[model samples]
Target: MTRVLVTGAKGQLGSDLKELSVHLQNIKFTFIDIDELDITSTEAISDFFSGQVFDYLINSAAYTAVDKAESDKETAFQVNAEAINSLISVIRKSQTKFIHISTDYVFSGDHNIPYTEDFQVNPQSTYGKSKLKGEEYVLQYENGMIIRTAWLYSSYGQNFVKSILKKGREKEELKVVNDQLGSPTYSGHLAKAILDIINKDMDNSIPFKPEIFHFTNAGVCSWFDFALKIKELAYLPCRILPVSTEQYPLPAKRPAYSVLSKEKIISKYKINIPDWKTGLKDCLGKLGELR
Candidate 1:
């Protein structure tokens, strides 16, 4: 049986992957989080992987607090950068493949056009910088897929989608930024796509062009547009007021146009990405189950 180990087992993406584990065939899974596994501790990871032989390591662990990351860069680096390096050191020796989840924030987002794989990275946020380092660590291993996704959310964990639904119920109006652009990547959808890549065993012997590819549901919108759709779907009695980035400032800067092109990932994997709006509606229908 193929053994697949997923870090950040309790996160939005990890939780969704756990839910789907029931239907996966010929796989024994080990899902670990900070509690079960302290990835920051090199000794801990060295000891853990030393005894186990996992076919794949799906790394979902990260320091996701955008504003907090500005001040807590050390913590972010420990988890996002060092932790990844630790795992890569061990996994590089094994035949196991890696599927590292990354963010679109790694790019500068200055371009109004969709960001292709070859696009240069000039991250403006601490979170983005840390994640980029993690990407580099994963890329060191030739047999790995550093899947870069943006604006991720699911019917699980603390996420923008759930946060909006929660606040929308309490507030009469919500202010959202209209400047930043990206796609909403439902965690379940992204997880499924990654698993498909492993299951199909896509050959990378052919020199893959821009090994780093963008993944988001079809179509794109600004944060303001996303909030509006969420309110509409949930039927929340709240007015989503669109505003500029200046209206809502944070400690960490965000990409003004971080939209990424999915043409490569789609053509390679043939993934059928649903629109974020469609994903939101379905996820909202199960919001009660999320908590």
Candidate 2:
């Protein structure tokens, strides 16, 4: 069995990965949250990895508080950048296949076209810069895969979709930014992709080449459109008004156009990515079940 070490075990993506792992009998997963293993402490992580033999390290641990990262830059860098370097150090010694999860925030969103894997990155926020630093570390090793996703949400965590559902049910009206454009990635879908990568490698279905790839739901839309869909699907009688970025200011400046190109991942892995609308509906259905 392929042993996999999954960090951030309690996170939405990690939780989904764990839930999906039940079906993959050939893979053994060791899930660890920050509480169980402090990622920022190099000594702690180093000691933990020294005793275990893992074939793959799925690093989902990150500092994702976008606006809060502005004030807590130290913590953000420690978890997202410094800790990543520390983890890579241990993984290098263990000869583990590192799979680092990254974000679309690494771009400045100044382009009108979709961001390709080769696009020059220009992070505009502290969080983005820190994540970019982590990605840099992963690339320096040159033996792992880096997957960058955007607008991630799932039933297990606090996210835009959940926030919309909560507020839409509470308040009668809400204003969302229509200028910002990107793809929404459901954590469950991403988890499946991760497992599929491992399965493909085991079966020799596709030649495993470690490189940066973008994975998001197939289509793109503005935040306003996403919110409207959420409201509609959740059966919330909320009025969603379309607004500009300038109208609703945030501490962290978001990408105006950060839709990632999936051509690379799609062709390479031959994985069929669901559309944003379809993913959203499925997510809402899952949420409904929890309620």
Candidate 3:
């Protein structure tokens, strides 16, 4: 069996991948949440990797408290940067294939067009910088892939979808940024796509190195537009006021437009990753199971 280790297994993506394990073949998974495995500790990493071997390591663990990250950069770098460095060193010796999850924050959202893998990265915040460093470390590894995804949400964790639904019910109106634009990726969709890519292409020429690939649901929308859809689908009576990024200023300087280009991932994997609205409906339909 090809043993796969998914770190941060309790997180949204990790949990989604865990759910995906049901339909998998020939690959066995070992999920380690923070309690089971601490990625920040070298001693723990050493002990874990020394005892059990894995063919692939999917790092979904991250210091993802975005607003809190602005205040706790050291902790963020420790988990997002230094800890990833440790994982790379260990995985390198085992010659393991690593799939490091990263964010779209690496790019400055100044561009009007969709962000591409080859585009210049100009992160505007500490969180973005730290995640970019994590990407750099994984990219340094020869047999690794740094997948950059954005606007993610799921049932297992604190995400935009849940937040919107919660707040919409509580309040008569909500203010979401109309300026920021990106695909609202349901975590399960990306999880399935990543697994499919690995299942199909583990052997050939090994296409890209530390190869940065963008994966998100098909199509695009602003935060305001996204919230409107959420309200409509969930049958909530909430008036959404589309505001600029300035109106709802956050500690993090998220790019105005971080919509990642999916042509590479879509074409290479030949998987029909659906639109955000379609995926959202599936997720909501199963919201009971999710709950």
TM-score of each: 0.94, 0.97, 0.95
Once fitted onto the true fold, the runs of candidate 3 whose alpha carbons sit more than 4 angstroms away are: 202-209, 289-291
What range of 10 consecutive residues in model 2 has the weakest lDDT sum?
282-291
lDDT of 3 by residue, 1-291 (tens): 888899989999999999999888778999998898788999999988886778889999999887888999999999999999999899898888899999889999999889899999989888889999898888788988988999898877888888888888899889998988999999999899878767765555334345778998989899898988988889877888988888888887888888999888877767898999987887887685222
Q: Can you list the residue pairs that collide in candidate 3?
A: none
What lDDT tens digits, residue by residue, belong to model 2 across residues 1-291?
889989999999999999999998888889999888999998898788777889888999999999999999999999999998999888887678889999999999989889999999999999999999999999988568899999999979899999998898899899999999999989999999988887887788874567999999989899999998887777778899999999999899898998999999998889999998888887888878222
Over 113-178, each residue of candidate 1 has an lDDT whose tens digit, in order, gives 998887898889999999999988877877677888999998889888988888999999899999
lDDT per model vs. reference: 0.85, 0.90, 0.87
lDDT of 2: 0.90
Give me the candidate number with maximum lDDT. 2
Instruction: Write down the TM-score for model 2.
Output: 0.97
| Cα RMSD for candidates in order | 2.5, 1.4, 2.0
Candidate 2's C-alpha runs over 4 A off are: 289-291
